[model samples]
Target: MAEEEKTDRIEKRRRQSPKGEERRAEILAAALRRFAEDGYQNAAIGDIARDVGLSLPGLLHHFPTKVDLLLAILAKQDIDSADFIGHFRSDLRSLLKGMVDIFRRNAGMIEVVRAFAILNAESLMKDHPAKTWFLNRTARMQNDIAVTFERAIAEGSIDGGVDAMAMAAELIAMMDGLQMLWLRQPDRFDMVGGLEAYVNRLLTSLGLEH
Candidate 1:
């Protein structure tokens, strides 16, 4: 009888543990929807909790604070983005093409995109919590693009005289600029097409295959 009771208790715990994880996932999903729709600062934690049928402390039990939830969302995005970028890591042209494809896909999620845009602009403030994150993201992107350029140059795929680091910075600037434009006039502006054209021109200028 003692062994049976222990086995039943263990089974109950196993079942309850998954319920806890499921509740956490539910909170994250609701938080993401709220964040994507309203941006980070404007998204109310109380609202998110209410949307998920939980009270303030209940939501807090899972995510501590709004910043914690935002960080988790960003971390998840980074993981997904890493996977997306991994598919075409072979060459600069391939990576650019892959990026354009990603832009096209992301266009459907305008609210989420807008949320990122707002956070990016707001995080430029000196003391913003996300400032360091944005800065690090920019640096990492620049480095990756520079590495791709260097690889192309080494393989005789591009003009050797061109500065990889400078070109990488320029490319990042163009990408950011185009995204802003797309957000303003999404229907009128063709973000993916614009990127494709710009990349083709860049390759042409570098004497590289597009």
Candidate 2:
């Protein structure tokens, strides 16, 4: 009887596992699609739940609030960003290559770029749950790039006299601007091409062999 009970428990757990993971992925996909198409302010939590064939209460059980889901989505993107940055260090060329690879590797992320850009632009609203989080997160990314810049300059791979902070700002601004432009002309913007061009231009201006 004990063995039979153990087997029953195992079967029950096994039956739940795939369904749970499937539901989680379904929720994420629905959120991504809605966020991409309708902007954050316009997306309804119920709609996301409906997209996944979940009741509103069921979705709430997984993510207590809409902001929670948004934060989770951003967190996932942050992990991807960190991985790419980790794989490519202080080299300007590697940085450029990494960005290209990331854009291609997660093409679906471009959808994310749409609504995120809209929200980021209005991030000055103090009540915005994302404002503080986004600000601190971006600051950290800039700090990482600044550190990389410092190392590259010290190693003579990149030129001296460049302010790491300023360079980091410029790089971020360049990428953000390109993303904005890409949304308007997704078919023609060539996201990778623009990033590579900007990096090459910056390197060339600094007298680097990039």
TM-score of each: 0.87, 0.87
Error of 1 at 109 (Å): 2.1
> Model 2, range 20-94, lDDT digits (tens) per residue?
888877897789789878877778999999998889999999899989888887787777666657677657667
Off by over 4 Å in 2: 1-7, 106-108
Q: Model 1: what TM-score?
A: 0.87
Cα-based lDDT at residue 137, candidate 2: 73
User: Would you list the C-alpha lDDT of every candidate in the order shown?
Assistant: 0.83, 0.79
- Give the per-residue lDDT digits (tens) of candidate 1, residues 132-164: 888988888778878888898899887788798
Maximum-lDDT candidate: 1
In angstroms, the error of model 2 at 179 is 0.3
Clashes in model 1: which pairs? none
